[model samples]
Target: MGRKLEENLNFGETESLGIAMEKEDDEIYGIKADEMKKEKRKKKKIKGEEENQNLDFSESKKKKKKKLEESQTIEIPEKKKKKRSKAEGSSEEGNGALEILEEKEKKKKKKKGSGDGNSLENGEQKHGKEREEFEANGAVVSGNDTKESRYAALTSFVESGLPDEVLECCKNFRRPSPIQSHAWPFLLDGRDFIGIAATGSGKTLAFGVPALMHILRKENRKTSKRAVPLCLVLSPTRELAQQIADVLCDAGKPCGLKSVCLYGGTSKGPQISALKSGVDIVIGTPGRLKDLIEMGICCLKEVSFVVLDEADRMLDMGFEQEVRSILSQTSSARQMVMFSATWPLAVHQLAQEFMDPNPVKVVVGSEDLAANHDVMQIVEVLEDRARNDRLVALLEKYHNSQRNRVLVFVLYKKEAARVETMLQKKGWKVVSVHGDKAQHDRTKALSLFKEGKCPLMIATDVASRGLDIPDVEVVINYSFPLTAEDYVHRIGRTGRAGKKGVAHTFFMQENKGLAGELVNVLREAGQIVPASLMKFGTHVKKKESKLYGAHFKEIAADAPKSTKITFNNSDDED
Candidate 1:
């Protein structure tokens, strides 16, 4: 009876092992469509063999179940015997075998479960094709249109509660710009967003209004003992920071919100004094903001809203670490917003770190680097060294009208000053802006340009992104920009406020890389593209470079190498 019980238990284990093997085979049943069609005749012969195997499998399963039931009956008597002799060697050995078998089955089941999870993850990756398309064309939502409908309702600035002063201030009164229309709904609802818009498409007001509204909503909350600001806006350049602060003050004053602008240049005394008194908003460059925070003068722990305007520019300027440190000091629950003209991989990574998992993404223009459609693009093919003569002739023609505000863009700081001197020698009233200029001079230069005292302004790329001077007539690229995106932004300085303007870009043989992108912009805006530019455009095979554009200035032969340092240790008393 004991031998019969042992045989029955072994037979039952063998049948269970066969069942597990058949289940694994079922998992490998996928057939490639093309391969199956080629092997259809061969498969027909195999089908008969497979049917016979299935019949045998069914019969074996039935016999196995019957054996299992019989084994259970035999095990009942064995359990009685084991109870009588629980400490016997044979009984202990039998129990040990059963325990080993159970552990092996558990491991097999675990392996199958893990395999399913891996397959599920791969399926999810395959499903992200639509998401890529939606991001590229700002058309559909990520499977939900609730937010899309809300954004669609605010096509006009009047729909969103803009103060009468702000409404009157807007050059586009009848309808909101593309960025404004898409970003208002999310910002007004206090949701996080990453907005991408062209340079002159009114991004300041897109976030400025919401910052005011958010400050007003939290007006009654008690602040810390120090005069901590409630809202903070960080920009890459001092001029841009001041421009943003001025816009915020104009729109937020009606709601009793005070804004203070802090930057590196100029006296910190006035900024500290203003912050000593309570202010609702603080707008400044990242460097000055970091200085104030380290001195315990500026407290951000109580800030309820924060905006990183021109985020891509900030990253390129090597302020990403400082920006992250400032963000860390702010309240984690704060409403965060970032705006950049181009969405690079670095910007995407920054958004992922700070924003919510599903933050609202608002893309106003084309997904790629694009110029404003309202601006007409024109390309002039010329040699690199002869661009100045062409610019002089073009300026001579456009300088006749007093309303013609011509902005000339150059590549370097020295180039800006040289051009200013050359233009001044020709009896043209020109103002130049670059990084080497003092803050006071920069302010004075901007003032003269805005007042139309200096009709033509020569500037570096610093003035490309965020200076809002009205009635700019013509933009001449005296020196070609390093990339097509910079070219787009330089031209955006003109053709603003729903008015038509012209952009003249000088293309050299080295600038053939930009021809493709420049041609696309021209074709999209319904301008006449020259045949040379169209031919050059064919060389653009893929997307433009991330940090630098197509062209980079080569290092001069006399440039000093900082990698090797020489120490002069001789002490000579003269």
Candidate 2:
């Protein structure tokens, strides 16, 4: 009888393992449709780019064109690839994203490079047969009236009655974005999900609120170094990770959850000590994190919840190898979730390889990061390098209101410094963040800007995606982004908390080839198109309102409107 009972126990364990495997397989299934947009070509290549033709991609004609491009969209659950927009430079662009930073700098390399003329942009959503009808007439299926959406109620998840002391940390409004609406539910339930939304859409909260929910709901007994981290959120950049960490720390504080931020650029000794002591959640960039793990100061064995925020950026920045290495450190049964503003090749591939089946895909704003819907994107054509002058004029025009808190972007670090200096000379109190600045300086600059002490922040792509300075009145791109993806995130910096903001870009002559990509980006972000694009050799749709509908309306106006949020200080009065 003892031997028979032992045999029964052994069989039961094997059966349980099989059941778990089956459950995982069942939850992780997906089928990707065609993904690539047609290689943007001259009107000569495609007969139908009717200069100003309002081509709604939700149309069949465009679908037919897309099917001809690459044509393979296999919905995989665990593969990762390089996102194409990581595009580049007259100054020896290393190829896509323009310049692949050499482990060392090539300071001597300088060229008035005319143009490589490659076009990059976000691909439209995979449409089913029903999409064929919508596209034929050039109108998309109206969004399912959110009046019926599961998230119509705002006060449920957003906690109220919070003390002013906690709210004073970040001044967060008590509301969640649409992506947060769905993500919070699954995350709170300990379920993993792939969040497909635009940057600045509050995806941080989707992952953050959920993580906080777990922190709040779960009983937090005093934990030791041996106690595993409850959550591990990985971002690609120090700025982004730190930004997320700051928000999480503020939000979590009210609920009694402690979060430690880890990233490169500053000191690591502090991170080591913090991890050694223990933390409820550890948010960080991959490079610094890999070092901590290698040094044995950070341990992932105890982490059960993992989030890859801006997974596409991680893969694009060549952190896939590092991502895989880190994931390997986590427990096999851990829950993994990835959030990206754009679901490019790299993003989809990572999902296929790292994600389990049935990972709910929440594509907010068409996997374009709500770029086309919420942003008032404008592409102003500039004549050659006169971009600096054009930028000044644009700033002067937009700065007519003293309440404007703005972010200005340039392509190169040197240019960012120059712009900041020029603006400062012109009596604008501006701060800049770039790879060239000491990490501590960068953090201070960001902190100052967030505190409303610095109204205008000059930045390169490094400050583009992850920094969370909200309610910025304007975003000026003195240099056009290499791809539409960057454009999306850049403009997304403004128009946050549901407030209408303006995005003015200097589209140089060399960037004319990216016209399609630019239009697609703006149409997605809900920005109005300038007629200048048509005369300068590009096809675009007739102007229509996407999110706030033209004329700079408040995005957060729907909220019980609050006092004007500005970063300007006493010096601005001078």
Candidate 3:
């Protein structure tokens, strides 16, 4: 484990930390060791310290304090799903695009040959046994079956005039993930794009490289600016924007680009001064950036490259109007890029409204795919009452790796509070994030969690969207998501940036819709769809019902009032 993470663990969830030998790039993976004594000592040492530090935290917040009750064991129920509505033909669009997709599928098939059937039959599980045998026999599959075995060759080798140094950084990044492979060419060509891919597939660098290149080229051409940010990246939340800003700083430093971030809740006077000092790139959540723009503190007229980091998230957070309003102020002759992990109907409609004709539409991964192969998927079939018992048991069983961090997601703010408290009392260092927490507290909690002061966190869907924390070992969905797309974002939190991880979902009575969709998407992505989620098997459904609301969690629970929010990358962190 990194010293930074270890030193920050005040409530040390004791484990066999000594056995966690590092790997290449300072990675770690090890077999679980059995021990309980160390955990108890560490928990006792940290409990009084943490409780004293935040004695008034809950009272200070808007929500009432939670009173713990006697623990109860929840029961698991058999799954009931709508029938797999036949082997429906691929829902190909009537336009010429479907033909292109068809051609791409053909090419994909030719590349794979035999395992395609086995892959299609049961996803990663079917291949597991055979793969183990193959490995035992020293047989390897090449071509498209490989992660970085480039489905498409690098084209438009250079775009936005990035410096040689910036390009060199990627040369050592091991492999170009699907998103990077698709977006790099278009970005290098200085063309606009609507890049769609799952999280952790190198999406940061897809846009980061182009931005860096754009700045370096500009500097080479003596095209430096002191006032306006040349590139503007937006997201829906501050945490996500902050994470994006980190990526830009890391990758863009090799080039000559300097960046800045602007977001809400912080005092704006300093941000105005930062803007006056000038920056080449600005990554920020849309709300605060817009405030600065309205104040004439931040202008976009000279911005050459505009990126909507998580377009779907912006729309989901209720920022469509604000984003459009900001876009209207920018120069019309600009390269516009929109990226989303899941392309929703609203996002598609937004793309049509903004992007130029036939603008590069590069798509990768399954529609609701989780992260890469390194991330395992599991499902727990249990009722609401038994959930706490199962979660505790599972955590206890798996709490051997101190280097590992666990993120547990719940649907309701109340449930989030409950879960966090339960875990914290159980000798696990835990924190939580929901809209109810003040911005300062939220920031501190995120910082603490990131620093590993708390290795376990109970988060809402808000954390699922775009926050990029590295080295996470697992993401547990304490409650199932309302849509298949949400499920993708939830699990995508783990197995990030080529690290090995797992996603576990606990299913119950109200989670039928989500559980069903999750199974299909997992199957399509060549991931393991847990039998617990499919105990009832697939059943045919007569028709599809209109989605009742934007998100079931948001609609069902009262948290923050949903405002029209514009989400861009983090310029505040710059």
Runs with alpha carbons beyond 4 Å of true place in candidate 1: 1-152, 155-178, 219-226, 401-403, 531-537, 541-574
Q: What C-alpha lDDT do the candidate models reach, one value each?
A: 0.71, 0.62, 0.64
Query: What overall lDDT, based on C-alpha atoms, would model 1 receive against the true structure?
Result: 0.71
RMSD of 2: 29.8
In the range 1-574, model 1's lDDT, one tens digit per residue, is: 3224325445566445654544433344344545633443343344345446446545755764565644543555645545544455455544765577689897664443322111122212232222211322232212123235555546566777766654654654567767777777778888887776667777888888788777767756553423777789999998899899888887766656788999987888988899998888899898999999999989899887889998878887889888989999898899889887666656666666777544555555444555677787788888867877888889878776645789999999999998899888987778988988998899899888888888789989888877787888889988888777778778988888788888888888887877777777677677888887676655654543455564533221111222576988777836
Error of 3 at 451 (Å): 3.5
Against the true structure, what is each candidate's TM-score? 0.67, 0.62, 0.64
* Candidate rank order under lDDT: 1, 3, 2
Q: Top lDDT: which candidate number?
A: 1
* Preferred candidate (lDDT higher): 2 or 3: 3
Highest-scoring model, TM-score: 1
In model 1, the number of clashes is: 1
Question: Candidate 2, residues 1-574: lDDT per residue as tens digits?
Answer: 3224325445466435434433433344332222111222222244344322224212434444344322332231212112322321221222422344442233222110101100011111222211010110111111112123342323434343334443344355455566666565455555557666656667777677667555444464453333457789999888888888878888777766678998888888888888777678899888888898898888888677899987867887789888989988987877778877655544555665666533544455453223634457677777866876777787778876645788888888898888888877887778999889999999899888877787778888887886678678889988887766787788878887678877888887677767876766656545677778755555643322332344433221011213497886686585
lDDT of 3 at 146: 29
lDDT of 2: 0.62
The TM-score of candidate 1 is: 0.67
